[model samples]
Target chain A: MLYIHHSICISPQFTFPEVNLEELVRSTDHKLYAKLIVNPDIPPAMLRRMGKAVKLAVSASGPLLKQYQNLEGIIVGTANGGMEDCIKFLNQIIQYEEGVLTPTNFVQSTPNAIAAQIGFLSKNKGYNITHVHRGLAFENALLDAFMQLDDNPGHTYLVAGIDEISDYNFNIEYLCGYIKKEPVDNVHLYESNTHGSIAGEGVAAFVVNNNQKGAFSCVKALKMLHSTDKDEVEQAFKQFLSENLSDNKTVDLLLSGENGDSRYLDYYRLMEAAVPGAAIGRYKHLSGEYQTSSAFAVWLADYVLRQQQIPELIVKQHSGGNTIRNIVLYTNYQGLQHSFILLSKS
Target chain B: MKVFVTGMGIITSIGDSVESNRKALMEGCCGIGMLKGFSTRYAETLLFGEVKFTNEELRNMAGVNERGVSRTSLLALHAFKQAVSSASLSHEVISDSKTALIVGNTVGGMCLTDELYKDANQRDTGSEYVASYDCGSVGIFLQQKFGMKGIINTINTACSSSANAIMYGTRLIRKGYAKRVIVGGTDSLAKFTINGFNSLHILSSAHCSPFDANRSGLNLGEGAAFLVLESEEVRDNKKVLAEVKGYANTNDAYHPSTLSDTGDGPLLAMTKALEQAGLAPADIDFVNTHGTATENNDEVESRAMISLFNNKVPAFASTKSNVGHTLGASGAVEAVYCILNLLHQEVYPSLNFNAPIAGTGLIPVREYSKAPLDHIMSNSFGFGGNCSSLIFSRV
Candidate 1:
């Protein structure tokens, strides 16, 4: 089993070093951007050059690298990586019309910049990779780390997921009907009878290892699918549960990716029906909606499994579960990339 | 649990098919020249290895009639069709739940940089290309087109993207997650990359001469390549192209855009790959060097090669000299060339080399010749210090 030793998240809520997500920070703006206060420990020289995504990723994983000695690998996932820089570079191109362009923005625009930054800072010479498959990005990164752990049980791995919102991207997505037309309180996000969800972004990182010494949670199984059919999703969920979960106990908490988009409500409804006895919880309202928001969901699941307390603000429906043991996290992006991550108490 | 290559496909400036690429390699034909397909201010100033086709022509060639499909996805579909057909994978087999698709792409729909800029500016109710901007869009398009039901992912580690994809796919098969995997990478020339490389002052004014003392810089290229990898259990009656003996990936952890002078990342990757294959450095018959023609890359790679091979380097050449640097697709394209080298028992020469680097004193194969080959290694190092090496052996 792969154990999550450290989990760090820079979400909209106050979920950084510890889980203090009881208070809800409602946003009046259409985009509920992450409130990631910069870590002062980073050098000013390096901090000035990093984009928001790279900053969040490096800050979240830096402390863990210092705490641990032998990190054998670094894997990261980002759907629309370094969009701010990409947009900046594109604007320079348009302004200059293919003339002299700045290289800094272009250098930071690639998707693997986060992983590379982490590796550079840690001075780690090991297996390093990056995944960018929309919502499945985080899951794919976790799966890659799990496979690495399966190969060498003694090595530690740093896995992270990061994405940042840019004004250009937000405006384009808004025009594409991916974001809500008007601002609404994020606390009441699910009650809005709208076709689109709010836009948000953040970064999350986890230090995973095979040893369960100080692990917060143990990952049981992770599965990803690319399908839009409801029946196929349900069937895959059933198969996944049967293969990973024990016959005696069912899922304790069902963390669903319900981003208040009516088009995808049926997926969450199916997930709710699939896990009848589990307490249903939603995280998109707190974190808003992003491509790799499932990383936040995983971080939240780790918190619940370790702390044994579900935040009342995120609880959609309670099934009288005082002691949380097994949690099933389900997420899908625009009906394209679907993933399921099963976590349990260590 | 051995991973075997069942099929291979590639589309480069030198050729559109594997056979054509092989023929061009044997003849030492250089594809780098003045850009003709796209118009830019640097069109005359800098050299590029652009595929000799327009966007519309590529769309028609790939049989993709859909509007707003990026050139990257078109090239991917074209090469993917070839790979699957060569593998004799039926539609039913390709769409099987046990089949997976992993692609590496650095430039996605951004190839339409002007269109994206206009769309973002006007917000013109968004266009078909709006959703295709991300790196994952290429894989999503392919997955939708082929009705792929298994795991679909995209890796974007710059030039090493496809090499890591191939490595990840092989690991998935070895771990029993997938029975068969279609792994490769695609990248198309765009103003975004051209200006990016140019701004970095790494674009060559002339055709790049890799490993040469006076090598100026690299000529940007565009293309796609795919290889169908299957586990030993699924290799029943399938024609094996080559055996994926070993692979490894390592980060330099020293610099973001350049490698250390010691070439630690490349050395580790080569050593680990050889270790995984249960072979020593001497077992490798030839080496497909990254050889981006940049000063740092050529020198560092030469140092790494000398250190790893213990001063007894094997016959090697950088196909980049012929095809230019294909960025994300370079790794897979070079891997296909390596397979061809093993299959045909031939060594393709590195083009335009007058003198070796000052200290390393390394000389690459200067002429194409037939040689008895058993195992060959391909190296792909990218931005962010991502270095990957793959070794393919005779089956």
Candidate 2:
């Protein structure tokens, strides 16, 4: 019953609106250092208050807030929420002797500040929560919202997953070998034999409600893996297919968090092996990799389900149904934070 | 839907454990004091309800090796150990997959972070001390403390962190994720948070008088509290302290540090929590408010309470008068205070209150009162405009 009324994403690629998804996917050859959402009209004062993740959340959550006048609850997911702002303020305090660090920067440094900012600006307040459990952060928030929706029908919840790449973050990842040294083409992500995948940034939000009004799709099921291996994923995927996807034929499209790490590729390959005839699509090329970027997959699933068309750049095959009906998304962080989400047309 | 508290533990200025806290609350004693835990140049200017225990004292209490864990982790381990033992689930449930540890913390070993900054040779990135700042240390410590490794997590949404942690723990249990969860929050007095709030100029130079006319600002305190939340199946084995009937979280987003003058987010959270409990404003017999004693916080909280009760506000008091603002643990600590109120049918006084504020005519309990209480509402509001209300009913 959790219907995604609206969703928005901001990444290094040009994937802001629905139209930009194709453009972003088509032009994903280069490594994106920082993904700052470009909004020309918003005044500098407002923009200064937002970090990369905050901007993306605002843009995505704005449309949802406009659609629903009252928000019953707000839940946010982030792996490293506002770490950029934290570094900024801490650097100031360490370097400036605690003289006059701007309160604005320090205030937004907290992870939940994004939700608080949205609630304050929209003047909608009911319930607000922030999750920071690495990749499962978004899943936990989604689960909480789904439970809330189930408990109280006919209420809308704003759920957002956000994370940004900071200079410190990039340096640490580089030191830890979490980012790729060699850049590769977007279409050949799985083919690239690299030690690490490119680190990216993004924020995606959904206005979830039980009242499935002119919605494109519904969240069929969400399952997270704690001690999952390739075999576990395969078994879980088969279980999900048999129980939820009763049709048993094939999923229309499969969006995956394929970050080009050979060690992590087995899970996605297992998923591909499960859904034999489904078209395979990868998003880390355009969106890069963050903790909650799987939210982007949910957005993509909703998009293809609503439009009934897959962008040529994302379509690995055309053999599946031309009119998209089902999407199964697989996401993980370093092969540890694995989750499978099933979405289908209403 | 019927989650019961099987065990409770708290460490605060008023008391070090549940029994002492109950005694102090029943006797209506206050624990606020001039800052004596550390040597502060601003010592004359600021008063705090800081825990009197030093790092060595806490380590001796926990019987842990020195220089092994951060002070923050030490305090957390203390409270978490007590809660786990009080629940009697220590040896019996170590391998229980249904048992999880969820902690709410704001400063994750900031004292260690500061020590590293001071001692160049002692600072080692490879050490567990530095890695503890990941905010997972509390969960990791709790896991090792009892040798239980189920669902481990931490909530760090500033002040309302523990309230949200409790909320998520209940939801996870209700959804069958876990059968029992050791859920609570902990924070230690650190130069980092103390200086951080001090830099914001919201730290009071005197005792915090929540909702009082002369209230200037908050007096920062630090401590921990833990409650064992059990599924209905496990509640019968242990005495049910109270039931977490309803809870809600809302964000104000008005300002990063300051709350909105209208208190919209807090009002919504309280109203929704009451509604979820299937109770009206009149049903609440007493209210434990998040009166941080800040100029804006107390006034805004007072306004929210008045608007929610429509001028017929329940008998209320800010236990912060005794413990100061304990940051993230404030929610869970105050929640235990509310449960204690329901159990004993006593209302503790809000100290240093002479007259009500100008516009908001609400008056907190100035002395101890014994009354039959059915339901009590506890409010916890954080700096990020993160507001939460948890309602507890006597079982």
Candidate 3:
């Protein structure tokens, strides 16, 4: 059994520990960058060298590490990691024509930098790894944590998903038709009849343990698939549910990765149909869309389960329950990689 | 719960196939030379272990006619196809939806750094190569081509990427998530990496000499390698190459680019791996060391080995001297080399080593010799203090 003890999210919404989730922030930028609540506890000397993504990751995980002890490992999932530093290094290479270049950008550009930074700050010297698969990145991290907890049975793990937006990367996605062409308020994200969804970036971290005491929720099951066939996805979903949940129990809430893009909305419809009795909710409108946006949904699910209430901003349809109990989070990337994660209140 | 290696395939600077790579290792052949496959401004200054194939030739070798396909993907496909064919895996088996594919890569399709520069500058209106920039693109291409329906993941932890990939695949099998997994790594030489290393001042101008007293730095290399790992039940009359006895991963939390002088991460990794395999220090017959020829790595690694083995270290060698450090592919490439050692009962020589480091006085295997070996260990340490070790025992 895997249980989540603590979580911290740095997203477009007010998701920090002190902020009220009921207050939503509206944005019209092409890219919805995360508003991080800087933690003054971190020394200024250490904060001076970190990039935006690194700072967000370290700050978000800092409080959790303090609250929890004996972290056995750190696992991170990122699609585009340290993009600011990567672009800086690339620009220097172009400007100098391969002459002398600074090493700071090169040093911090790797995808594992965030994980390594967290490990260094926490002083935990156990297993550390970074997963970079497009959509399945976070699911892979979660699954690895689950397996590790299963094997050890009592150790705590730190799992996180982080990504940053750079103007260069956002422009590339815009040109490739991955972001909305026209600027729209993020509150009206799903209402636009557009070809692409709004671009967003954020970081989310969780402290996971095998024990359920003082935990917000327990992870029941997690599954990932690379196929796009509807029948195959449905079969995998049914098999996963049967293997994890009892047949008599039904999911209380279903969170779908339904962006405003018409091209990929049918897949969400298919998933919603699979669990017809559950209340439907959407998170992209609040968090925007990224490869690892499912992580934000996970944080949201944990919050809802702990608070025993669903915020109106995220509720797409009310069907089965007045109180949150069991939740399923489903997300896919460009109709290629699909993920399903089940969570229940503790 | 035993996991076995059913098949292995590789393409590196020394050779293109497993047989050729083994032959080159036995014959003490070095593949480091001036860069010829790709044009770079540093072509005349720095040496590299290029794969000796142009992008066009590699595309033809991989039977890929796609215009925008990167060299990284082509190299990966070539090795992947060889591994699948060598294992006699049928199309039905590959598309079974239970076989996972886990790949590690640092420079995915960004090998076309110049094209990316142009595209980023808006000089071109979304080039076809733009889609191949992310690290997941290579794995996605392989999954699409092979029609793989199972779990697919990509890892990038600098040089230790593929070692962790192998470890992750084993865990998935042990946990009953997948019956079989295709695990490996691929990286192609690119200016992005070359310039990055150059800025760090760790790129050697000559062929690297691992563990030598007067070693300068590391030479960047590129290639791909894959191993087919299957559960014991799925082995099903297949010839088992070797058993993945034990594995462990640890972080130094020391520095972003260098290991500590005490070598805490490497020591812990090797010790934990040995403990997992239910073996002692004396049981390991040979070791494939992560000797990158840098001033800091060779000494740190030597100290770690001496500490773990209590000054009675086993015979060891560094293949980086022969093929240069292949970065992300170095881990799996070295793992394949370890497997070959167990299969042939031979220890390959470490070329370009004349003397040991001054402090630890550790000497690598200087000559190729045939020996009856039962178990071997491989070490891979990456930037950001990521350290991993794998033990393979003869079945």
Candidate 4:
């Protein structure tokens, strides 16, 4: 019932809105920073006060919100929200020795600030929420929207996953071995047995509803898991696929987030073995890795299904089939956080 | 499908357990005073609803030996264990795939903003707390503790965070994704929030007076509360504290941090919740309100109540007057308090209130008294115009 009528993303890959998708650019700065996309409608004063994450989220979802007025709700997901503004406020507190300070940065520092700003912009005023969990944040938010759609038929929702890279989060993640020790060629992401990934910023948004008119793709199922045990995961994966697929057959494509982390290669191998006949595709190499990188994979699923062809750059091991229909995107983080999403060509 | 509250646990500035909090409520004792648990520049200048437990002590209470986790997680664990034990839920039952955990929190490990600041600026390997900096750390910490396999997520919509968590929990059960859910929220008083609220100029130097004509602002507090809610089919002959009758979440969409002057969001939330419960304003016996005592909140909430009840506003009180506005934890915490009202057929008085606000002229219950109650409403409105209301009725 969850159909994507319109979708767009702002990432290191490109700003794909009303415009066409662009070729991927590999990460060279150890971090793939999103190219800041600006909207002319946003007042310059408001833009001046917005933090990096707020700006990215508004720029990505604002157009959709403006085009389609009075959407029922807005659900946003983020791992580290407004770390840039938060750090600014913290630095001020330290610099001023707990003296008088401005509230703008602190007001915009909460994880829900992105959704709040969007709420102010759209003024729809129905139901609004933000999910701040790490790996499953987007899935949770999407499920909330789907739950609403199921409750009230034919309701439109704006769902998004956003994360902005800042010096604070990037440096800490780099030191913690989640990011590559040094800048590596993202083009050769999986070629070497490296221990870490190249981090990136991403905001993927969709205008979704149950009406299905002019819809490009549909998300049939979503399952989140916390266990890393192979048997448990395999069993869950089998159950997820069997329950979601009408034909109970192999999916057309499996766009996985195997972000070239050598430590979790075995987990990816286990995943590939679970689905034998599916065409394997990879996206983290193009978009870089993040907490909600699976969002980008979902966005790509809609595109591949609409175009009925897989982009060769993203194809790791392509099947001979030319027509793409069912896509199952699997995303894993440190082998601890994992999710499976079943998306179908409309 | 009826969602029944099977068990509850709470740790607030007033008390640590259900019985203790109930006793404090009966005595009309307030939990807000000078800050003690966490130190800040406003420590002596402003009042807070501190939980009266140090991090090390809370760790001991929670039976946690981990250091990387924040105080927020420890408070959550303290309440979570109590809820599980009170419900007599075994480890096997809790770890079942049908049992879900949906928690709401605001200041996760950021309560340790100082430590995070140090770790982020480091040149060498990051501290162990790097992974725990985000809001997910609290839920992830409790998830690992129980080995919970069901849908686990953290919600953060500012002050109404946990009320939305409870509402979402009901949706999951209705959708058949879960049979039972442990839903609640936890927030620790931290320099991060204190400074944040202080910067907003909403932190009251004196005690907050809900519904008072000369009310100032809110006192930032710290606490945690949780409810173990189960579908009726899973009742299995368990004692039901109350039935979750109705709930609604709405946004004013007028501003980021302030509710509109007309109480548009509050009115919608309360009206919709009553509609879902299939009740009228007259059916509500009492209301645990989200009266933050700020100039905007008190007047707006009062106006909303007057409009919804047709000027015969039900007996209402803000628990924030007892425990300073707990922010993210207030929704779930006040929910536990409302369940208390339902169970005992009594109402708690607002701690600090005198005359009603000038325009609205709404007066809160000033004395803890026994009342025949059927349905009790709890309201939680947060920053970002996120407002939610939940109703609990006699089973």
Candidate 5:
């Protein structure tokens, strides 16, 4: 029952500086990369110390945090924490005989270094936990915050998720066949018949608490499944909806993790069919794919809850947004580890 | 929501199992010695509190046939197996339903990274080296070996990794996420960590004497420990060793390498943990301080303890002097030390403390003392200004 007091996202999509996302999507000039962050100043010393992901996470956390006085806990999630730093460290260590290795890069290569940095920058001396569970990384941290709020009320938790893609990342995904070969319009990602989704990077943060501050919807329930099939995923979705809703009715919005990957299309397709009356929306096209992209879906949910409007480009059916009281977000990594986070207007 | 510790296992330089570790602590035996586990290029100046077992011995005890397991994972598996055995949990039970494993290793498989590096570059490198360097492989191997389905997470928050893991385990039980969980951390000495600490000029040549006025720095050690936490519903004949009364994590958010000069983060974390445990600082009988013997760490931590206790601190000691600073495993390792203290009713000495600090006027207990200790507090602070404190009480 934690409330989302403030939230921010720095992704490839059009998210920052604009209150409405539809406007950003319309103003996009290119389609290859989609980082949503606005223009930011990068200090020279920071550039020497931080990679793109760390920079993005630190910036987002800094702005979104309002009550820095008694910041109770910090929970960070990343599919690959500091892979770029790790690559730099590894290449340097192997290239040079430990003589020219930069301790700065090597020190910040650990996954929790970003959280540590956030702690330092914010002067937050509260509980800090870092999670790296592939796709469920962000969801796990979010759930941890939810549980923390439930057990100890009136405390604010900083929940952040970040992941970045480098040439090494593209190489690994290229080897794993997760990168797209053919050019596809992100605006029309669902129309594609291809299997792989485009790779992207971003960081998102939320100041959440048990008390509903009315700026965002309250998260009703969250569930993570390992090795979920299409049928079982649909059944679980229905069970989740039933657990929350007294009326056997459709939700107002259904946010999805439909990356261009064909193996996982059936999961979203099942979701689309299950929620007949809801306005279905897919975001991986605008943001691309990372371990914690579901966090972007959360940002989207917050936006929809606040603005009470859905962009036509995002509307799959456009049937039930006049009374958009509920938004159910479904996210997973390659359809293996799935998460369901349900939120409603406060 | 009651979280009970049903079983505990450890593999430190002092011993290989919980019983042996307890006996050693009671007998006032120290395990810090000259480094012998791995060959070091900078050998003359380095000392460590290293376990005597080879990787093969740990792997054999852990029942892992795969050679891809890293030395850190080997230590983790060994301790995890011992925990299961100590708790009397059958393999069938673990394989049947959602048993989760929460491993907190700051440097996951750095030892493997060392091997991978030399094998690739040096022609004279040994042919026997074969292990994966990926950080997630440790958790993946444990999950595969044990056949667990519940939430498997790897926390990499430096020194507080395993303390956060135990905190997560308790939260999982209270949240009804899992009926049982194996929570702990493991770290092995590697060239990267050693060189990193050496570059920082914080590696002590001799055995570490934490909180000593003349202590220079800490001697790095390697080990692992895991505790089986059972939800109140599942506790059968398994006697509760101690209850995870409360825990809190706080970030200094001050500096990457240094804590705040005021020690506010550690103080806040300890206060929150005490509040969660429904106790005051006066209720804590003993504290397992994160006295890494480094000048900055000891002085700042002593200042924080004073602030928390309002000038009357509990009888606390730094066990790092005995086992060296185990890094990521230190928090969890010391936690087991706290539980051992609670059960044994005696406080271990801080070892090698001769004088008080110039400003804080704080002195740790120099020798073991017999006392009716019921509750113990343990602190672990890390590089990112991450500080965590846990309160464990005897059942």
Candidate 6:
């Protein structure tokens, strides 16, 4: 099991900086942009050069990285890594016909930039890596952290999941109809029965280690599956729950990543069926749908595990978290990637 | 549990099959030349290690009728099929839940970013290119094609990507997560990368010269390489090419695009790999250095070698001198090259070297020679200070 020391998330509803998410916020447009919370400690000069994802990524985990000086590593999972900067450079290339250009955008364009920036800022110079496997990105990063921590007991590591939407992102995703073109009332996302979900972006950073001292909870097990069939997903989730859970422990809170995308709600229904009578919850409404939106669900798992109540979540707490002990997060992205994380109150 | 390389395949500017590439390396042939397989203004000015086949030609060879598949995935599919066939693995075995697939890539469908941009800019009903842009798209395509149900992942640590992919595959087998794992990487010449490297001014005007005193820059190459890694327990009578003895990944964290002058990351990675292998530096017979031929890489790498080898560096060379720097694919390419050398008891020569650096004065192998080799160390370092080293020992 991996211990979660600090889990911080920055999203549109302001999940971080210890804000009280009393009333969930909704985006007037289909795209839900994150309000960046910059770190004052980072020099303005350095911060100016970082893209939105990089800036918020470092800010979300900056404190934990600083507190734990000798970290084993920083691993990040991202789908669209600074594509805004990359597209800007490509545009420069086209506009200049390969004549005039600056190297800033190109340097920040690589997907590892987020993890590397954290190391550059902390100057730890340890193992830094990035995984860009679409929906499974965060789960892979968490697995890396878990495996690393499991290998070396008591070692601390920083793991994060980040994806940001650019002004052009929604339009591009809209062309494929992967994102809804109409303005989405994230509050009433399921009511529209639209063909696609809203475009959203956020970053969640966690300090995971082998030590459980002062930790919020423990990541008991993590399982990921890639499938195109709803029945397969249902069976895989049932198998995952049975295999990962010890002592036949029952789930107290189960968060379903139902984004209300018409094409994918059936898979979500199947997932819900896998765990009957569990205290069901929904998060994509608050964070919208993105590649690593599962990270948002993880942060919520920690929140509900500690707060003893859901924070304005959809369905308004299905059964109970009054004495919640096991929080199972089952997230499916685009009906192809499925993940289950068993979080326990250690 | 030891990880053994049961089968491997590669497609590069040098050649596509193992034997052809071995012949080129033995003859000290250089594949860096005018770019081909695409329309780019750089075709007239810059050099690239582009494979001989065009995208359509590769798709036809791989029998992939899927629309909008990028050249990156095509090259990947080409190498992947060869590796699986060479391993004598059945379709059922490859599709089993005990088999894992991992691909390391920095360039995904962005090789077709031109089409992606056209689709995005025009917002004309979505193009097939949209479905191919994700970094995971390549692995997803392979999984769907083979029905692979095990762990599937992609690593994008710039140049060290495939080395990390190989490392992750080894870990999966060692941890019993899979009986066998296919790990490698792919990249194709893209206008996006050409312009990106051009803006950085790191594209060499001529063929790259590694460890040379005045090495200019890197020649961006395009290709793919894949290796079927199996646990010793599940070798299934397959010929053992080599044993994955040790590996390590470390970050310099000193700069975004440059390695530290001290070569701290490479030094640590090499040291850790040797420790894991339980082999001393002297046990290694040859070192396939990262040797991107950039002003920074050769110097930092040389410094690291001197420190690790205690001034008695092993016979070192950069096969990148033959295939040019294949970016994300270089690690696995060089690993397979090392396995070939280990299997043949020989070493390939580095091309275009006249003088040594001022202080290091370390020169790479200048000629092909038949030397009894037991272990080979392959190094791959990338942007963002990602450094990885793999140790391959004769089984």
In order, the Cα lDDT scores of the candidates are 0.90, 0.77, 0.88, 0.87, 0.78, 0.86
What digit string (tens of lDDT, one per residue) describes model 6 on residues B56-150? 78988999987878889999998999899889889999988899999999888888866767765666577788778767889989998998888
Candidate 2 structure, TM-score to reference:
0.87
Q: Candidate 6 lDDT (Cα, whole model)?
A: 0.86
State how far residue A234 of model 6 sits from its true place (Å): 0.6
Tens digits of per-residue lDDT, candidate 4, A44-157, equal 998998888899899988789878896988899888778888888887877787789988888888888888888888876788899988889998988998899998887899
Which clashing pairs does model 1 show? none
**Deviation in Å, model 5, residue A13 alpha carbon:** 1.5
lDDT by residue (B1-395, candidate 1, tens digit) is: 89999998889999999999999999999999998877788899999998888888888888887777899999998889999999999999899989999999999988898888877776557777888888898999999998999889999999999999999999999888899999999999998999999999999998899999999999999999999999998878988989999999999988878899999999999999999999999999999999999999999999999999999999889999998999999999999999999889999989999999999899999988999999999999999999999999998
> Candidate 4, B393: how far from true, in Å?
1.0
| CA-based DockQ, model 3 | 0.71
Question: Which tens-of-lDDT digit does each residue in A1-346 have in candidate 6?
Answer: 8888888899988687875677777786786777788988899988878888898799898878777788888889998778778777777766777775788998898889998899888987677889999889999898888767766787888989999887555666777677776666887788888788888888999888877789878889888888888888888888888887765678887888887788888887777777776778888878888888888888878877787776655553476436878888888877788898999886
Off by over 4 Å in 1: none
- Tens digits of per-residue lDDT, candidate 1, A161-246, equal 88888888787777778888766768778998788888888888999988989887988899999998988998898888989987
Worst 10 residues of 1 chain B by lDDT: B118-127
- Candidate 5 per-residue C-alpha lDDT over B1-395 given as tens digits, one digit per residue, 9 for 90 to 100: 78999888899988998888877776667888777766665455777888878887877776777656788888888788888888887887665445677888866656765555554343332334332354555676677687665777777778888888899888898888888888898898876777677767788887777777788888888899999999888888779989999998888877777777898778888998999899988999988999999989999999999989989998999988888888878887998899888887888877878888888888888777788887888998888888888999988
**Which digits, one per residue and each the tens of the lDDT, describe model 3 over residues B97-179?**
78999998888877888877776666237888877888899899999988998789999989999999999998889999899
Preferred candidate (DockQ higher): 1 or 6: 1
Q: What is the interface RMSD of candidate 6, in Å?
A: 1.4
Instruction: State residue B168's C-alpha deviation in candidate 5, in Å.
Output: 2.3
Q: All candidates' TM-scores? A: 0.99, 0.87, 0.98, 0.98, 0.88, 0.98
DockQ winner among the candidates? 1
Rank the models by lDDT, top first: 1, 3, 4, 6, 5, 2
lDDT of 6 at B60: 85
DockQ for every model, please. Answer: 0.80, 0.27, 0.71, 0.78, 0.31, 0.70
Screening candidate 2 with a backbone cut-off below 3 angstroms (N, C-alpha, C), the clashing residue pairs are A116-B253, A127-B249, A128-B249, A128-B250
Better of 2 and 5 by TM-score: 5
DockQ score for candidate 5: 0.31
